[model samples]
Target: MAGRSFLLRVANVNPANVLTHTDRALYRSIGIFILLYGGYAIVGAASFVDASSNYTHPWWQWLVGPPVAAAVIAYDRAVVGRVAVNYEHLESADPHRLLRRRTAGLYTGRMVLALLFAIVITEPLMLARYKGEIDAYLGTVHNRELARLEQSGAIAAFQRQIDGLRAQDAADDAAVADLHRLAESKRSAATSAYNQALEDSRAAGVSRRAGCPPGGFCDALVQQSRSLNAEATRLDQEASTVRQAQEPARQSRATQFAALNEQIEAQRTSNRTTVESAAGFGARTAAMWELVQRDFWGFGFFYLGVAALLVCLDCAAVWLKLVSHGNGYERAEARDARRRELSELRRHQQELRVTEAATDVADAGLDTVVREQRLLDAAVSQATTRLLAELEEQTRTALTPTR
Candidate 1:
């Protein structure tokens, strides 16, 4: 009730406490700005901090910070030390409970608006930064892993295949060379035999004209010439066949070489793509990481600030209630003094009891005995109790319902 009373005063302090048409419109506008910006900032900071840190997020650090600040401020404003001079002019009238409710609602709206603005401003930027960093890191890692795997075995196998094809190409070239050489030798031998046969035929014609008919030697020479010519032609054809057979092998070799080139090109392209991808990912990751860090700090500060504000407000409410109800802050101060005195009194009483065990209760009452036993130590405490008793009696009389 005391806290609520303080908040009501704050609400009344606002020039536009009542919502007229124009005031209502202005209130809406304020709400929009505060909620939007506050939510944004808060969310941004929260997300950033969450992403950036490895530690568990602080769940309630903000809770105590604000209230403690507000309480100290309230205590200062209340001025608790001089109670006698500031006791007059206190009002006893209370506003309806409905007024308290309305005040609470309005205050809540403001706090929520502040929170919303925080989220709106902070969350998106932090998130973008975080995502970029993560993506880049992953891309670089993937590329490195793939490269390692290829180096381990895949690349070597590809090179081995190319080497085998090259060896086969060489064998094909040698076979083509042997076929050309055999063809040339056969042609040269055929020409030589033909020339010899022609000479023999001329000599035989002369001999026939001069004496007996041509004999077996001439026929044998002609037959041998024909056989040599036929043998040369067959050899030439066989060599041509060998050369023709080499064509498919040569073509196959060319195809194999082209395929190897294609494979190399493909690998190069793939590596280029992967590298580019990795670069992009790295950039994004760095950006996101930075964003996350920024957001984290922002949220931490914002939450802390808001919480501090709320706590101060709560303290103000209690102080305001005391002032408004005519009790004055001195009552609380006096009450605290009383509690301290009571504690001290209890300690002295305990000591007295111990001392009495050796003596007897008939000596004096507990208070008098303690007062005598520790006069200096109990003086302030005795005065505080007297003042506190008077303050309590006054507060009770004021709060009592009228007949």
Candidate 2:
């Protein structure tokens, strides 16, 4: 009666103690589960957040969302009170240490998971950058092509200028030829008139010497010859001056045409060079574009693989957790089996040590027995030789008795 009354009193005093302990255990288990679930959720959420935005959103913002929620929950729930109660009996033991270890492991796993997600995400991003670079290169190539076309047109125009200059030079040459012909004709006329004048003078002198009286007709003829000679000389001088002046103009026009022709040729060469350079640039740009496309396609496949791997990892984790929850007995049995294997290995090692010692003893005894047998073989040989000699002597003695 007294034992029953004591038990009732103790149970009455702490009716809620058992429930409290159970609640604390349940909460801790829930906390561990929550921690793992939260980590996975955070990882997945962060991936979504990172992928949702283009290159603009901040990564830190995505990272902070989950932790912020957890922090708020912790603050509102007074996690400190619960922590104190749960750890009251583990003051020296530090039960939270296990939680801390788990939390650390969770953090490490999350980091790895996040890194994997980032790797998968960054592939697409790098492909996008590659595409942009190739596009920009192609744009530059196109611009150069356009500029080259314009340059080619300008070169054609320069060629036309050269052609016009050549035509003008041809006209100048023709004018020069006409002037030369006119000058030559004028000089011929002048020479003829001078000769005529000389002839007239000479004839007049002959007439005077022959005693022929000089007539007014001869004087008039002389005057006419002098006037004609002077006029011819003036015309010849004017033609010669015009020819000299035309020579410089024609040479200048030819020089201008030659210079224009050189410029046109240079322009043609430059245009050709530009065209070739642009072609090279275009080829390089096209190759780069093709490379970018290839890389993008590769990245596309890589991203798909990563996504599938992530899904597989997630499914495996979920299945593992489910098995942990649903098949606790099997897991426990497996752990027990592992422990039994360890024990069995230790027992085998001990048995092997004992067997090795026994084998060493047996080998030592065999060595000693072999040495004793070698000594006994020598003694047995001596005894057998003596016995054979005695038997021979006995046979001789017996033979003599019979005689």
Candidate 3:
């Protein structure tokens, strides 16, 4: 019984005035509708925030839900409360009541607002209901976004740079290797000629020692050995110089290759992050629509049915009030309103009468004051005329005595 009363109060009903079972039941139903919508609004708002945000906290929805639900409930209450039950027979007879009659535009505006709220709340609930299908669709979206990112201009440019650097590095390595091989081959030839010359010098010395000759062949052979030894030393020095000269170039190529590879990796990481962040509400909505388009008869119809149900729920309070216009409670309410208006009008008329009496008394007092002032002015004028006449008579007596 207490709970029922509370619900009725939520529906803006005066519990004392609710006498009929129909009024009790209807107001209770409206209240229940309001409570249900509040709960749905909370859940829907939380789901909306969770779906839309990149970083979701467990308690964040609690923070979001209550405020949004409160606002929605307040709006619902206002919408319901604005729908005045105009029992036309009673209203038409009373001029004051006629002035308070709601217009068609008011009803239309309330319904429009209710419909908008229904759409706002329904979408998130629908998204939550078909989460699995939407998730699957989102998975496809994620993969597609990733693929698109891979083929994007920036990533492609990075890959091309990396490939070019690798090719240039390989070419540089091959050129350096060929130079080293050629230098080694020339050094080997110089070393071999020196070795042969040394052997010939030893043989020529042996011939000289055996008394065949003095300084001709042996000296020539020794000098050839010396020249070949100098050539080998020079070739080794040239090879060392070539290696020293190529070291900086080799290091530079290595640095360039490494830098380009790092850049490509960074770009790839950015692309992956971009794809990962595409799982927001807008993306999910698009995915859901795609699903609807694919399975229109199944999902689309279901979607429409759910939306209609929500819209009906949201507008129920107003519609109930509108339909239950000539009910007993409304009649009582209208009667009470008319009584209060009449009492107020009577009090205003009484005040007007009191004000008129006070005004009449003040006007009479003002007239008396004017009459007294006129009498006083007449008395003062008669006294002044009498004094002047006596002065004139005294002046005539004095003149006649002088004559």
Candidate 4:
């Protein structure tokens, strides 16, 4: 009995208005369908949230389903509850036709809403049905997306810049090494020549000291050695200057290389993130479409079938209400509604009559008051005239007293 009452409430039917077992069963059926649709909505919403890449909180994602289900339940209850039967229509010659005509717009509107809800609820379930296939398909999609990003002009440009910087650094290093080698060769030759000149000068000093004077070949040889030493010193200074000049260039290239590498890495990370986050609703839908396109006869039929079933489930209560018109429960409900309306109308008439009677009584009292005031004014005027006449008579008698 409690369960029946709950189902009646779910069906938006008053238990007192249900007059037959068939009516009771019908309402229970409607309530069952409504509950079923609500359950389906919850499942669909949960699947939608779970499949989405945007919502990262797994625990919170499940929480989204209940509120959505509640909303759907509320809407369904309202739709079912508002479909009040017009009792007067039952009196018509063709009651069912009349009822349909009266509620056609309402039925159409509810069906349209049902269809919308069905689509919203159906797509996610369809995606879930083909979860494995869609997941695999999404893998391909992510790979393709990543590949596209990597091959994009921006990434290519970055790579080109990096390669160019590396090549320039390499060429600069090689050029600097060549310069060092050239300087070393020149310095070595100059050192060798300086040593040879010193030895020759020593030999000349030894030989000339025994046979000659002060200004001799020994002094010339010493001067040659000094010139060779100066050449070696100049070569060393030039090599140091070349190295100093190339050092700043190398450092600048290194800085540029580091910065470019960072940019390239950042771009790659962004591309990876984009590809990884592509498992969203839109992506899944697109993947589903691809599956449909690939095997239209097999997957497409199942997809449409699922959607049709859900739409039917969503519209079942409304459809039941639509068709079960002029039934015992609806007739009772209609009679109750009509009875209440007539009762209200009779009460309103009674109040209006009471108000009119009160108005008449007030008007009668006002007329009586007006008539009494008029009669009082006439009596006062008559008394004033009588008093004046008496005064006039006294005055005349006094005036005639002398006779």
Candidate 5:
């Protein structure tokens, strides 16, 4: 697919949905990139894991990787579920049928893919973030130990003694340097003087060879050359004096350096013993906490940077899901949920209809019971009236016969 087409997929959920053919391809590409990046992170994490464990004691001192892996994975799943719902709602007419279908392999596949990102990508970055924190933590630990030794006047006293020696050593070193400079100046002057004196002597000889009268220009020239020669000799003597003066300073420097070296070696030996006497990784790690605790800004920046990268991938995955108006799984689930709802509604309606029919039958039975009760009451009343009439007629007949 063209890069533009991929960009189109990335533009929005709508475009992602519209580009049906490219969705899977883009997803695969994105997945591969995420996996590769994550792999690189894992390699770094491996190194960090070993080193951190050595310093911190419990190897799991690298705490950032696992939880982050789990969280990222959970997020990926939630995204998938949401997208599935959207697909069913928007795209599928028969969502119920789709819902019944179980694609365990598909979900499992996604989870496996997400694992590559979570463990490899996110976990390693977390380790990367902690690298400086751990190092600083370790340094602080060592410093604190050193400080404790100083406070107790163990290493500190020794160091102080050495410090004094070192100070003298420094002074001697400086003096030696001055001496060397002086010696060099003297040597240069001596060489120049020697050359000048030699040249003057030669000139004086030439004047003598020219055979000028002893009391005239030759004599004056000879006197001038001798003066030059004496000046050169004085310069040479001065140069030798400077060299002799430098020797003492050089000797002092060597003596001071030897003493300083001896003191330093003693301090080194004591340090090794004290360090061995001290506690192990725990104390060191505790010291490291000082450094690690202060690196919040650094940690935050790394976290945000890694988060941004992962979030982009997350967004892309989400966008892919949003764009797919309906995937088979989504359609199936939506259809199934709908079917279940309709089935529940129909069952409720059936129950209501049965109840209504039973009510009607009861009402009819009630009416029949009422009619029978009324007929029974009327028969009883009519029978009593007829008996009373018969009795009265008999009484009147008997009375007439008696009159």
Candidate 6:
């Protein structure tokens, strides 16, 4: 009694308790019959609810779950109360009439709830699915800007500027190498000329070759030696000038490369920061919209289908409640049905036993004693038939006497 009252308090005014499964043991026991009726729909709705609970979502996303569940219970109470009303009017205009204005509210509420449940269950996964869109959008912007800089020749020009400085430096090195080679060759030639001039002076000093005294040398040989010495001094001066000029150009090239490299690195770093800084929530939302447009025909349709199914199940839960009674009513229906079945079975069993008993009696020796009783019935029937014929003849004979 205590349990019943507790259930009643929680339940609507349904004496039948068809709307609330607070005591679901009744359904589980006689579930086969319910299954035969609308059990599939009942189970489908329940399984969907359970499955929704398992969807991957943050706790915050599921904030509405508890409230939605409360609403379902509340809706259950209202429906049960309606069922009670309908039950009360079983003989009146209200019996099983769910199309009435009062009853229609139940359906409407369920339809609305179905939409809510669908939203709650799928909303979290939906967000998770598209979370990458933000990063993708930002990354694209970064890459595109870099590509634009490349396309505008800014980066290439920077590279070329560095390469030109490097080339200038290399040219300076080649110029120094050529100067060294020239100096070596010039020194070798000057040494050969001096040696040859000294030999000519020796020959010039010979008395027979120069037509002069033994100690005297030719004057032209001395002049030629002086000129060759002057040429060697000029070559040395030229080599020193080239070396001095080469050092400055090389230093200038190194300075240019270092400064330009620093500028290029800073510019790249700044551009990267700008691209990242500009990507915000608005950009991500735009990306999300793009994803929706792209996938609406594919996976987006899948979400829609899921939502529709949830709605159907929501409505199905209510329909099952209104169309069928609770386990209490169903138990009675089952019991009564079982009783009829048992009665039929017992009747058939009784008839079979009676037939078997009759056969046994006929097979036994005592069965012959009833022959006189059987003959009595036949003899009575014959006598009645003869008396009827005799009466008809006597009537006809009396009519002839009057003639």
Q: Choose the strongest candidate by TM-score.
A: 3
Whichever of 3 and 4 has more lDDT, that candidate is 4
Instruction: Point to the candidate with the largest lDDT.
Output: 4
RMSD of 3: 8.2
RMSD from true fold, candidate 6 = 20.8
The lDDT values for all models are 0.49, 0.50, 0.73, 0.76, 0.54, 0.55
Ranking by TM-score: 3, 4, 6, 5, 2, 1
Model 3 lDDT, residue 246, Cα: 68
The clash tally of candidate 1 reads: 42
TM match of model 5 to true structure: 0.35
Clashing pairs in 6: 18-326
Span of ten consecutive residues with least summed lDDT in model 6: 83-92
Kindly indicate the candidate among 2 and 5 with the higher lDDT: 5
lDDT of 2 at 97: 26
**Poorly placed runs, candidate 6 (over 4 Å):** 1-16, 19-96, 101-153, 171-177, 188-256, 273-403
Instruction: Give the residue spans of candidate 3 off by over 4 A.
Output: 1-4, 58-61, 82-101, 161-254, 391-403
For model 2 the TM-score comes to: 0.28
lDDT of 1: 0.49
Q: For each candidate, give its TM-score against the true structure.
A: 0.28, 0.28, 0.70, 0.69, 0.35, 0.36
Candidate 2's error at 218, in angstroms? 36
- In the range 243-278, model 1's lDDT, one tens digit per residue, is 688779778877877887788667757765665554
What order do candidates take by lDDT, descending? 4, 3, 6, 5, 2, 1
TM-score, candidate 1, is 0.28
The alpha-carbon lDDT assigned to residue 351 of candidate 4 equals 100
- Give candidate 1's root-mean-square deviation (CA, Å): 22.7
